[model samples]
Target: MATTDSDTTTTDDTVLSMENVTAGYGNTTVLHDVNVAIEDGQIACLIGPNGSGKSTLMKSIYGFADVKAGSVHFRGQEITGRSPQANLKNGISYVLQDASVFPNTSVHENTLMGGYVFEDDEKAAQRAEVLYDEFPILGDIRQQDAGTLSGGQRRLLELARALMVDPDVMLLDEPSIGLEPRFIDDVFERIEQLNDLGTTILLVEQNAEKGLSVADRGFVLASGEIKFTGTGTELLNDEQVGRLYLGG
Candidate 1:
C-alpha cells in the first residue's frame, strides 16, 4: 500500500516545522527530504528503529546537526542552521540522550547551572528555589552529590535543570533510557505535567507505546524518512504500524 502526505492533516498553527529538510553530520546525510510540523502545546513523539535518524532529526531542530538542505522554521520564522544558544534564546531547549548532570556537583548546583545563560545569579537562584519546591526531592537533597542519586533521581534532576530557563519548546532525546519501569512512568508523568503547564514537547523515545500514549501526535520514521504521521491514538490503532513497529 502506498501512503501520502495527504493522509495526515498538518495544521496551519504550527509552532515548529521542517520543510524538505535534509540534515546530518558533515558530508553524511541521515535525514532525507523530511517534513514534520508540530502544533503549539502538543506532545509529539518520534519513534523508529535504531540508526533511523530519530536522534538526528532532534539534533537538526536543536542546531546540533548540520542542515545539508531545506529549512527549519520556528514561530513562522526561518531558523535553519541557527546556533543552539540562539535556539535556546528563542525559547527552544534540548535535553541530550546521555546523562547531562554534573556527577560530582550537588543537585542544587546542577539545577542552578541550567540558568547559566541568565545574567543574574540571584534570579537564577530564586528560580531554582521555585523548582525545588515543586520537585521536593531535589530540595530535600539540595546539597547531595548528583552522582549519589539513583537513575530515576538523576533523570529528575536533569529535567528540573532544564526547566530553569522556562523554555516554550523542549527537545528530549531518549529520556527513558536506563530507567526501570516505575521510573519511566515517573518521567512520563513529569513530561505530561510539564506539557499541561504549557511547555510543548518533542521527544525521541525508544519506548514507542509509552511515548505515543502521552503524545497528542506521533511520527514514525524509517530509513531516515517519515513513514507515518498522525494523532497518537490513530497511530496506536494503525494496523501496519502495530505489525511492524509495535510488536504485534
Candidate 2:
C-alpha cells in the first residue's frame, strides 16, 4: 500500500516537490503557500472546485505561471524559476488544459513538434516512431490533419506528443475534460498504462471520483490552498471530503 503524508517534506522517493509555493499570473496570485510532493512512480491527482488554483499549481512547476515565493524541486535539484524548455530537457513535460494541437498540421507533424529540443530532425522522427508504436492509432492516422480528429483521438495525440521526450514526470491539467464519457474511461486507462510503464503523473482533474479512483496519492485543494492530503482510498472514503468536494 502507498504511504500517505499530509506534510510537504521531500522523501527519498519524491520526484517532484513544491514547498510553500505561492504562484500565479502577473500581479495575481492563484496559489498560496501550497505544498505538495509527488513520489516516484506514483500517480498523484489534485481535485478541487473551480478557481481553487489547481491549474496554477501545475503552472508553478512547469514555469508557465510566476512563482512569487517558495521553491520547486525535481529529483532532488532545486529548479525554482527554471525555463519550461529547461524543465522539459531535464525530463519533465506538461500538457496544458487548452487544445494545443496544430490544427492545420498533420498528426505526425504535430507529434514531431514535441521533439523540438532534439538537435537532429532524424532523431525527432525516430522518437516519434517509438511513440507511434506505443500509440498505434496515431500511426494509422499519421497523415491525417489534426483538426479532423475526434475529441478522444485528439487527447491521445496530445499525450503521444508529450511523450516524445520520454519524460520522467508528466503534468497533466484537466486531461479528462471535454472528452466524452466513453472516451474518458479510455483516457484514464491510458493514464494507468503510462503509470505502469513507469511515468510519474501529476494530474489536475475535475472528475473528483474518477481522479481519486486512479490516484495513488490524492490532494484536495480549495481556495488556492491544500485542504487535505492522503492516500486515494482514504480521501475517497472521508465523509467531510465527500460532503464538501465529492458531492455527497
Candidate 3:
C-alpha cells in the first residue's frame, strides 16, 4: 500500500498516482508539479501537443526519468526513485515508445526476455506459450529472428513480452506510432483486450483522436502541466480540446 502525504489525496480505486511530481532527464526538468491519478482497470490516455511532456509523464511513473520532487505511488505504495527493475518486480511494467525487441534474437527468445527477473525458466516458458497462443503471429515465427518481422509484428511481440510479468498496470508510450492504418486499429484492439483482461493502462499517444476514442478517461497536458481531465467521450466533445489537440 502507498504512504500518503498531506499534499496528496488518496482516491478510491486509484491504481497509480503522481502528486505534484517534477521529473525529467538528467539536469533538466520536463514535467513540473504534475498531478495525475489513474483508476484501476481503466484505459487512460495522456494526450498533448508535441514535446508537451506526455512521454515524460510515462517515464516518471516507470522511473526512467529523474524525479526532482513530489511522489509516485502504485496501488498505495510509495515508489518514488525506485529502480525500473524493482518496479517491474512490484507489478509495474513500462512499454517504451521505440522498438524494444532484440533484433538478433529469435522471437521466442525476445518473448522469454520479458521474464528476466524470474528465476524459473520453466515458468517463464509457460507464460510465453500462453502469450504466443494469444498472439499467433509470434507462435508462427517463434524460431525466426525478430528483426525479420514487420513493424507491427515487432510491436505485438513487445506487448506479448511485457505481459509475461502479469503486471497490475502497464505504461505504454505511443503504441500506435508509425504503423499502417490496419495495424493501428489492431494495436488499439489489442489494448482493449488487455484492459478487458484486467490490466490498468496509462498510455501516452500521439494519435489523440484514436487514443481518446478507446480510453475510459483522457488527460491533456500542455507545457508539462495537466490542462484537462475527463472521460474520453467528454474530452472528445470539449470544444477547446478538440480544436487544440485533436486537429479540429
Candidate closest to the true structure, highest lDDT: 2
* Candidate 3 per-residue C-alpha lDDT over 1-248 given as tens digits, one digit per residue, 9 for 90 to 100: 11112323458889999999999999999998888888899999889999999988888888888999989999888999999999999998888999998999999999999999999999999999999889998899999999999889989999999999999999999999989989999988999999999999999999898999999878888998888888888888888888888988
Comparing 1 with 2 on lDDT, the higher-scoring candidate is 2
lDDT-based ranking, best first?
Answer: 2, 1, 3
- After superposing candidate 3 on the true structure, give the runs of residues whose Cα lies further than 4 Å from its correct spot: 1-10
Model 3 TM: 0.95
Give per-residue CA lDDT, model 2, range 118-154, as digits (tens): 9999999999999989999999999999999999999
The Cα RMSD in angstroms, rounded to one decimal, for candidate 3 relative to the true structure is 3.9
Task: Give a tens-digit lDDT track for model 1, residues 141-165.
Answer: 9999999999999999989988999
TM-score of 1: 0.96
Model 1 CA deviation exceeding 4 Å by range: 1-10
Taking every candidate in turn, the Cα RMSD to the unseen true structure, in Å, is 1.7, 1.8, 3.9
The alpha-carbon lDDT assigned to residue 180 of candidate 2 equals: 95
Clashing pairs in 3: 1-76, 1-77, 2-76, 2-77
Measured against the true structure, the TM-scores of the candidates, in listed sequence, are 0.96, 0.97, 0.95
The lDDT for every candidate, in the order shown, is: 0.90, 0.92, 0.89
Worst 10 residues of 1 by lDDT: 1-10
